[model samples]
Target: MKRKFLLLTTFCMMVLAACAPGGGSDSEESNAVSGDGGSGKQVLDFWYIDPGEKEKVYQEAVERFEEKHPDVEVKMLRVANDAYKQKLAVSMSGGNAPDIFNSWGGGWLKQFVDQGQVLDVTESIEKERFNELALDNTTFHDKIYGLPLGLSLDLVFYNKEIFEEYGLTPPETYTEWVEIIETLKENNIIPIALANQTKWPGAYYLMNFAARIGGPDLFNEAFLREGRGFDDPAYVEAGEYIQEMVEMDAFNPGFNGVPYDEGQGRQLLYSGQAAMMDITMSLVNNVRTEAPEFEEKMDFFVFPTVEGGQGSNKAVGASTGPVWSVAADTENPDLATELIQELTSQETAEAYTNRTGSLTAVSGVEPEDEFVNRMYQVAEEATHLQMPYDQTLPPELAELHKDTTQALFGLSITPEEAAEQMEAKAKEVLE
Candidate 1:
């Protein structure tokens, strides 16, 4: 009996000893698996332009992405629009570039691609689902480099109350536009709110007018072709048109000294002091937030057409928004590609557009804001969408165009002289 009892005790002791170590091994294995989980906490550095009130939306998206990607951490860096390019260039040259960043289309992307600074995200992204022009803009030298997040069509925004008080509908042609200006002037309302001191905003008017008068293909061919210049009569005519408007008191007083953002031009429109302002679709959300009561009073239309011109009926401009690209030397190029693909997906594109009240690169996403919706419809119906002249032209030539346009506004130079100066500057650059 004693021997049998001792045998049972021995068997029990052996079973407990075996089970204890096995349980410990199981816990250790679980810790190992979790600590070294798939792809393991990769830190991605991302840079973008001013997110404004939309920063919250981006933050929420980042949180959701992290939840799904448990192994990845995203750090966002926001830069001011005016200084972004310089900062990016410095960062890239110093070997401290972010894993992902944003750029402008066409020449901007072309420069980066030529320098081998950005990764090719062509096959990585679903290009078949994006807007054709948006996709086209990011392609350079037969290679795809970036994904366009939004569309940026130029539209004329007018204050309904100001227009109603002066009894003006949106003009359909250049002649009608001139008449509207005259009518508004007689009624004591500034016809246009032009703030030329910042130069680019003023250049938008000049460049689009040139496109409307010269045809869409003309400037592209001239600017892109070797040994060509902006001496065309169309350029002169556009300059003259702006000069005429300036002489007619079309702009508010002290326009040349006003900054683009803080200028009286935007405030004038919101306060119903100005009849019209030419700006991007993105500005709609800003106007709504700044003047909620004036929300219903705002409307948009395309710039008036010029008679006997190739691009008379076309929309001549787009905004300078961010295009997403990956670092060419990323340690995880595949993962970087995946991130861009996700960022430019239909869902993300729509979220960006909806948040900014801007047009998305994705087709079939309707804008919720009435003005933005109308602008999108106008852009879609238009025959062509010309890249903004400043973007298309060489940087030196673009600066010349701005200076000449500002000179015309200041009466420091005649329209003929402005045209002559532009040709000279273009010649210097081309030579």
Candidate 2:
């Protein structure tokens, strides 16, 4: 099995190298919002990356928040996902950062925390109120910097109707998983609906596979230079697993060219052209919103265990959804803290979950929707919820990881080569 992958690696790399490193994000204008919007009320500018239905939910929450405060006004600014980091950086540098902003809680937020740009809200938030897994990224050096808004886990979401038609049950091991993929292919069905054109979508495979092969501590040890680092055999082996799948036609045709944000792969699932999707739990909201009828047919299973692997089957690839943190320089720390509390309060948590069909990090909030309940359970059961590499690693190394992983999926780089590239960069940056 591995020999086949070794034989295909060089050839695939040569054939696809020229087409790697897909396009960039479209430049967007971001105006620095001031805390004083000219209103007499105590104004608080809040920036977040949610733009559509999520914005609506936040707006409703803000309305209630206003109703409670009466004298304070919250200004909500929705920023584009790709443009947000730069926007926040610019605003923070200009000393006009929002009172509170949503941030991914790993290396992304750590930089701000290190620079004293983020407030340590440890006293403001009750540590016992959130799931420990959700707090992993936000807590640095024994202090919490942000409040997690939601929890997102990556798992294999399958179409129950399609599974029933084929008499297939979710697999519990890697070998069984491959059998399912092969079986799907035999029937001319796409085994997995993956949109790798954006790069990050495909990195999940490598992350989850590495977690299963090397267990939870592999990446962290490698990242901190305690172990073999990125050249760890687990990473290479994970890459090999991905390539084997690519050679076996596990993903859709032209998967390297499909963009996830455009809903291409999801469309396949919606049409039943694909059997399963190993994607984020956020897909729950999209399905419930755009294809409500399909919700009943959808269910998920955790990524299967690998034969003789050191990792637990319960380990998960997960990230806390945008966590809200107060700016360290805010003049009204008390008011800002109160607003953060209001936003992630029990009422808002329930409202957010109800409106989005997603799991909030708030403890004791069970999603009424059955499918989302499964996602919630998976998050609960996760022994090691690994944050995505791009978020957990520094910006430059993170980009390299995505690019090389994308190249790996495109088979434009051999597993060994990809691992080597990552190790070299990690050494340069971290050492």
- Whole-model lDDT values for every prediction: 0.74, 0.85
- What does candidate 1's lDDT look like per residue over 1-431, in tens digits? 99999999999999988898788567656644543355677777788874564455456656767787887878799887657778988888765678888876776666677789888876666667777887788888767888777788777888887778777889888889999989988988888887668776777777778888877776766676543347678877887888778888888988889876654668888777887888766566566466768768888778887888667655547743567788886666776677776666667767777777778777778878676677677777776777765655555677677788888778788777887887777767756
Clashing pairs in 2: none
C-alpha lDDT of candidate 2 relative to the true structure: 0.85
Question: Each candidate: how many clashes?
Answer: 0, 0
Expressed as tens digits, the lDDT of each residue in 1-431 for candidate 2 is: 79999879977996676435421111111222234434657888899886456677778878887898898988788887657889999888766788999997988888888889999899877888887878878899999999998888888899998889888999999899999998899998999999988788899999989999998999999888896699999999999999998999999999989987778889999999999999987787778667888888988898898987889878888888779999997867888888888778888888787778778888999988776777777777777778898888888899899899989888889999999999999999888
Q: RMSD in angstroms, candidate 2?
A: 14.1
What are the models' TM-scores? Answer: 0.83, 0.87
Model 1 pairs in collision: none
The superposed Cα distance between candidate 2 and the true structure at residue 400, in angstroms, equals 1.4
Deviation (Å) of 173 in candidate 1: 1.9
